[model samples]
Target chain A: MIAGIPISKNSYQALVLSVLGIALVLIMLLSLSLGAYAIPFSSVLAILGEQFGLSLEGVDRSAANVLLQIRLPRIIITLLIGGGLGIAGAALQGLFRNPLVEPGLIGVSSGSALFAVVFIVLVPGLVSGSLIQNLGMPLFAFLGGLTHVWAVYQLARTQGRTDTATLILAGVAINALAGALIGLTLFFADDSALRSFTFWSLGDLGASSWGKFPVAIALIGIPSIMLMLEYRNLNALSLGEREAFHMGISVQRVKIKTLILSALIVGVGVSLAGMIGFVGLVVPHLIRIGFGANHRLVLPASFLLGAILLNVADLMARTVVSPAELPIGVLTALIGAPFFIYLIFKLNKINS
Target chain B: MLQAEDIHFCIRQRPIVKKASISVNPGEILAVLGPNGAGKSTLFKILAGEISCTRGQVDYNGQNLKALKTHQLASVRAVMPQHSTVSFPFTAREVVELGLPKDSKRNSERNIREVMELTKVVHLEDRLYQQLSGGEKQRVQLARVLIQIWEKKPFPRYLLLDEPTSSLDISQQHIVLDILKKLKSQNIGVLIVLHDLNLAAHYADRIAIVKDGLIAGFGKVEEVYSETLLSEVFDHPIRLVRDQETQQILVSSNSKFHSDLKISKQAQA
Candidate 1:
């Protein structure tokens, strides 16, 4: 009534979010229906029903297995990984109070990639026969992500304050160090291991399995909820640290919690998909610009928007060359870079 | 009442606020007026509990200021610094809403509208805060601080402003000072640091002249604005004249002993 708009503010936000969520779901279903062995939409839904113990008619066994065992996991993994990256990006941007700050901008991706490479290259023989090898890559990647962010946190903190400039500087230094270490690991890798590491670093959601779903859920879901709970606090923080303190927020505690939550989300995302970029940075910015700066709406919108972007990017990655897939990371960065440059110029023009 | 006893502060081992002592009673408007580098902002920071005093105690309403949690301090006092920059664009209404409690008694939209209107920023409510001009941003910030201090019932509220109207034009400066004067009628303790001497003389019930990180003088406005005190504190001459029609003090020209002084003596005779 005040703004003379058609819908209530909260309803408008909810409507937009629902539409995005439905679009993401539809894109995922479409993703499952595509592939070299194109399955029909009906068959895809049937396989989904079968997996959930619902009796569905005319569901072919081979098609069901392919949809359930392969396409379904890949799609789910893409959604989870993309959503996690988006939330992480939003949280980090809020924490740093800068739209330019992304999870990867602070070296979490490279740190995780370096450790993932180490795990793959040094223990190729162990992964060949070990059941735990299924968990090894993600576990090591998570640990690496945790370690890098912790170092960045420590470096950014001075007298109980996290200076954004210092944090960015530390991230640059750590990213370079991690990059060098990853290169060293690549030199000793055998041909097969090298290829695997290369693909992992470039990032792919091609290795999704039912066994990995629980891990992804635990890693992404927990932190996502935690970050969402901190939404109000993050909104206060956008007013700046001093104002946030005046609003009765524990500024130090909130910063640490946000950083840790972001780290966890980034770790889970990198473990699942190697090192996807741009989703976390671009999705949150897009949401903030479209909506307002309220994190209550921004965070959830970011999650849905992120899922859609990644799914669409994955769709492009898999279908562009057909059978010989382009890495999802390459597609995201290729698209994200130009868009990011355009955004910068647009912002500059607006300022001028 | 707000009290600071022997507050000592240093930045990088250089003393900024050295053993400063002051107190403000309820319904009082205390102005801290000083020249550049007088550490008025630092003193305000100490009172707001933004920084810890090296060797002093700040007591607010019988509770130790340092002991109270950040949220508790926020509930009691609202501080507006000289400059604020938000990296992202937020609507003016949204910015004002940040000051209210999450479960505020009044409707958030209505309250935002009230504060924006009071600050004469009602039309700018939908405008992006960052896109607004500097004076507009200052007014929005004033609205934010006012909403922060406003509550359902009358309680002892502390409003701390640091050069709030520095970015505003002459007319806007009067608008902000008038708002501060109105707050005094509501029995709120208003503490403001102002560079304009005449504004402080007109609006502030008491003036605390700070010099070299210390209170050079603190008393009634008339007592603090004497020629000797003004010249000594500023290290420059300022002529103070009283208007016969309005009986208001006007400061003009920077002369140590001018024609205005002779006029002041003649008017007293």
Candidate 2:
């Protein structure tokens, strides 16, 4: 019960969750409305109201098209990817017991990207503008993510256990190796392949549509939800693996399940949104700072906060240099780097 | 009572613990004494169900340790490792609360409060776990394990501790041993790993000395502890002699006397 926090253990989590929920809805509406077309908030609501058969009038046809056809899909993808990465990051941080571990830094997405590149270069027939190809990319990406993480896990494991330092070192080595492979692919890829690879590397959300929405949701949403449900087990793991086992938690199961689930979510995210970095790492850290490290609070809160963060970053990407859009990935780094530095400073001050 | 018989543990084709057989009965503290690398912690791990033994069986009451469900074993015993490291900056209160089982009918908050008070960590309820001193952390972990087996059931429960007193000061060590002693009154058996021979000699009702991954001696303190047995187990000359006035047996390492005698003999020569 820190004075400024005002959260008493049990009810505090519910209250924060409700608040985050409302804020997420508000941000979602704002993101759907404020873009290149500048649709009014009232019009956005009117467009949404029509879905419920309220039939609100006075909506411009073009604004409706912009809201439904363009912005709605982007927002959905952003919300899912953001939420997925956030919870994955939180679970991973809990598993590794290190605050600095994240999907972006740990080569999970790099693994997905590398695999997606391989699919594009090695098996171009699988992704030739067909619905199945669009679906096949995320599947290949998931396998890539699984492979990279599996390799890292194998490398980090010594005597049947994973230590934090070894895991970190393995992640670094995997990330470097994936980067080299990606660079090698980029060298020989043709024009269209090169363009797709470049956009995927920088994380382009412009290609999002209702067509790929269901696939992304199935991959990212399910795993993220599964991770969220293990909040108690994850909290138990904070006490280290041995203590967690004594507390009746299946520690090895938790590790394997979380690693696989996070890899899937991160892989799907990379395939759909390209390499949107820092949402996973930054969002969970911020949520933990605000709501203590209880996984019950941290997991769900990270989800909502992650969506809010990515939506805002995507908004900035669209509007900051109006008519000339910046990559969403670049904007997130711009936002995330300063906050990372601030976290380091805050941690140093606390230690002193 | 908890019983482990003929336990053999190996890692990478190397034997770490060999042919160890021991048991802790109700109303007694079994202190395991062993030098470093003698596999004391590994034995605790096997008994605590943290790892499976290569060969042997651990039984609680009549149920095989490996056969018992997690929740069933959880109700029967709790284990505190040699070092407890928590990642997040959990409040000491939160750390204790993590011990409560999902289906436990006991009032969790009350148990947390009572155990914290019992372990003398109530004052540290608000402090972050990582910020606590080593002794404080050990006490907090002790409180957690105590909370797990706090409720008295129809059957006896067990608590396995690995060097519980390693980080505590002399007074704190006494407090912990006293707490373990109190637990015996409630029919809870405790298996504690101890490095201090004197502490084990005084507090433990039974002592099991492990040497080179094998049990060198195991029995009631007075029956098993002798000059030759301890000296051989510890690789140091030891003597168990009665004090003339107190009529209580004292454990003496005798290093000073032996070294002095060597110097006198050199001078004479």
Candidate 3:
């Protein structure tokens, strides 16, 4: 018998979390300090320290204002949304018992995107800071995302059992429907509206400001925490739903909670930062490969790695062209696509 | 006691498990022996509360199965299904650890280790579950369910398993059944669905022979394991061999059915 085997596993996961946590801090600093206007890393720290009543001298006003007001909220929002997507992906994958299942597969992204496009095309004489434009589009898109999940969930459930194959098929149907709707709305969009739609579709983390921070916390932060608390449930679920039910998990209820939580995360994320992909789908796989597939480890690690990936990608996106920021959506795919191909080859070789 | 009365299940108006009654008592093993597609698994599923029967009810310790919540039932019983697979790359040890109730705060590591040792899967702890052999995987899954009800409680508990020995070799099969037999001392009743008649005859305290969606016989081994009944339930010519000293019942089947071939011999379901 192995003494302290579980302890060793716990320590290993703790070590992984610590490393990811430290790396996230470093990446957050680097992302903050090195943007279109480069501030010194120490100054960025000092500016942040000043908030906590720590006395640090030689703080420039504009630099502090830019760092505190512009960069910090964006960073915080990115972390929340990115972490939300990662954990959501991991949870949804465990819920469905498929590693490949992502936030995109169940029509959350497409449904939200469809609603966003319709809002853009339909609401004429756009007002930037008006009450309707400020809240209307996001609310519409969020509802759209949630409604699609309900539709897909009902379609997949038969005889009180959620069939896995049918869930994916239902996703396909909803996605196709949403795709057609998006195409239909595109017909009414003017040239300028079309350009903005293309940009929004490509995704931008910069859309979030200090104004949106509180709502982002309410929408994404709470759901991510709930997902994190579901590690044990997710672990049991990966054994297959029938086994989970026998092992004391309310399988149907867990599935619904997981899907709804995932929808909330992705829905609000799509609202805040337009359709950023790949991090949700691939970050969990990377964590599983590096560490084992225990949800206790997978969900948190996916969250950290997701935040890191997005921050780094956002860093490059804003800096690569210098003042002309590339869409984070384009960069994530560019970064994520090649690495995914490489992973496929690596796994194939390992299997052979 | 775990009791199911007149349980009938139907799929699309076609009967699967029809009007079958069975009970598992504390301190004994009840083996459900049947040919493939004889509704053995479906019956197991119904008793395990994985699915609600179309008719009749299951009661565990006098509590209606439908009235009891899943977690409530879980504290009193554990189930090992016929087929199970993990989707992610969880370690075998991790998979086994899932059996521990989320709210359980006991020495779980020791519990998992002890159960792994009991199931003879101690060496496969660190190995990825997907990499284990079929027999190894079966044992691991058995350990998972066993861990659920391993710690003794005041009330009687039940263990329901379906075809646990199907993937195991002769020695491994005996090991698994021996573990189940040991549960009787813990006041835990075990209801196992098995294919091998001799194994059931050897270890089962009581036997239920299922054929064509109904139980052909249910009683003590001596009253149930007759040569004629075994042959009829299995639909093949059969004989029973007895060890001279041990008086053990060994079932043997060879040659075709005494009756003419029927459609039941073909694939059911």
Candidate 4:
């Protein structure tokens, strides 16, 4: 109904992006200020500015270390992972043309989780070294995620064309198999390995350091930006593959690009954050509901909102239980599942 | 300006369109009519470059359709499938705007409005595409395709539509056909698959009746709409009648019951 509004489409898009960007920055700053041993707002600002040579007196050293060294890196990782999942989810939904579809619906996270479990339980000693612990786990997890998505894509393809239903079904089967493999790994784990597996599966962001940020950015952030750039092709695809082809879009190339980009993003996010859930699904859905279904708007909006949502969620994870952080994944699923159900009902109502 | 030369498309071992050749000249409406499995849609796909012909080639303005880059080919040809269902809620205007070329953003607003007006879907532009009636959706889709090839260039353009009026009421069907007629006047070729022979007789400049993956009859309406040719192609008894006032040809079904009932009444009397 708002389609007939007098506002120009370009202006409306610019307005929405501007407002969302401002809100995201505000939420991010609030997140930086709301943790245990909370840094004062001034110190948070000063520490952020000090890095750019803005010397402000009265900055506490401990607060600076906590904000700059500890919290900032963790928050940055959370933002990147959240944004990555969000854009990936939006792209996948547009490609599939199913509002209910998410990045994880293609078995990327489960496959990566399976590999991470294998690393923890099967070769526990390999993860103890700093180099392997930091770099190796994420690399192997990315490869695992990429492999599963490729496998699913291959299965879903018939005569070089991928069907949405077939892809989703293949994802379901791959997830079940990966889950079984993970369970088997769990069964063979020793006590220490068992604890670590449980921690990793629940998504521990406590290992966040400046050292891991570059790898996460290189793996997830760049691919996510690439997905966002596919706004036009994704929008065309919403009409169906044949329509897209007729619209001058290379439908097959778009499909393959989106699939690989989503896998890389979700793969990297899972490896870095340990299988966080719901941000990808919920953020993009909410963006579509608020704005129109234009992918040009939806994809970037998803990134901003996804970052805000996870930063806020991570803030909650650190503060709610105090000193004992709840697994971010558990919180996300608890929040995401009900929201997803509500979205389904809303869609049905609108359709009816 | 659009020609499909000896197009043969097969699925595994079954031929869908075999050695079928059809062409549409600029400033003409060519209607393809046939039975359910007559392969009209497959031929349209080959002409629009949606699928490759298994044994032949399509040419637009003397250029091979397959060899042209997709975007380049799209500038000259636009296709509307039989049914296009968008799951998400896109406004009708947004759907129409999707047809605009990437480089024509500066003129997009004007083009979108003009096409919507041309298709008689300007009123429905504000409504969600998913919420529109079947006829309205078809019109919106038509507008979308029209916008795609609306730009004037050195070469001719083609519009290919598949069963566009299948869901429309009588007046809506005329509105669509009239729009195509107007487009034809602009020197844009139109290729349409129609189920109604009468509508084809009214609007089409040429008629091609397809039967079992082959062109059974192809020529001007007068040459192609003979009683035997149509009846044989559709596998139904059909009679071609002309209107007394306008001299328009109309097709009527020669059902067995019509003659049987007449004979029974005569016998009783």
Q: What is the C-alpha RMSD of each candidate to the true structure, in Å?
A: 2.4, 3.9, 5.0, 3.3
Per-residue CA lDDT of candidate 4, range A134-252, in tens? 77777778778878888987898886556777988999999999999999988988988888777778887877888888888888788888988999899898888888888999888
Instruction: Provide the overall lDDT of each model, using Cα atoms, as 2-decimal numbers.
Output: 0.83, 0.85, 0.85, 0.85
The reply for model 2, stretches above 4 Å from the true place, is: A2-7, A122-129, A341-352, B11-15, B241-248, B257-269
For model 1, residues A169-287, the per-residue Cα lDDT tens digits are 99999999999998888888889898777677788788777877887888787788788788878878888888888777898898878877777778768867788888998999999
The digit string of per-residue lDDT tens for model 4 on B27-70 reads 99999999998898888878988779899889999899878998
Worst 10 residues of 4 chain A by lDDT: A123-132
TM-score of each: 0.94, 0.93, 0.92, 0.94
Task: Please give the range of 10 consecutive residues that has the lowest summed lDDT in model 4 chain B.
Answer: B260-269
For model 1, residues B93-113, the per-residue Cα lDDT tens digits are 778877886667657667777
Per-model interface RMSD values are: 1.2, 1.0, 0.7, 0.9
TM-score (C-alpha, index-matched) for candidate 2: 0.93
| lDDT (tens digit, per residue) of candidate 2 on A200-258 | 67878878888888888889888888989999899988888778888888788988899
lDDT of 3 by residue, A1-352 (tens): 1335555767888889999999999999998899899999889989999999998899999999999888998998999888888988888888777665677778888888888888878876443645576567777777788789889879988876568789989999999999898988898789877876877788977766877777678878888888999998899988888888899998878877887788888887887778888788889998998888889989889989988988888889889998889999899888777876776697678569
Q: Candidate 1, residue B114: CA error in Å?
A: 2.7
Model 1 spans with C-alpha error above 4 angstroms: A1-4, A51-54, A125-136, A153-169, A350-352, B105-107
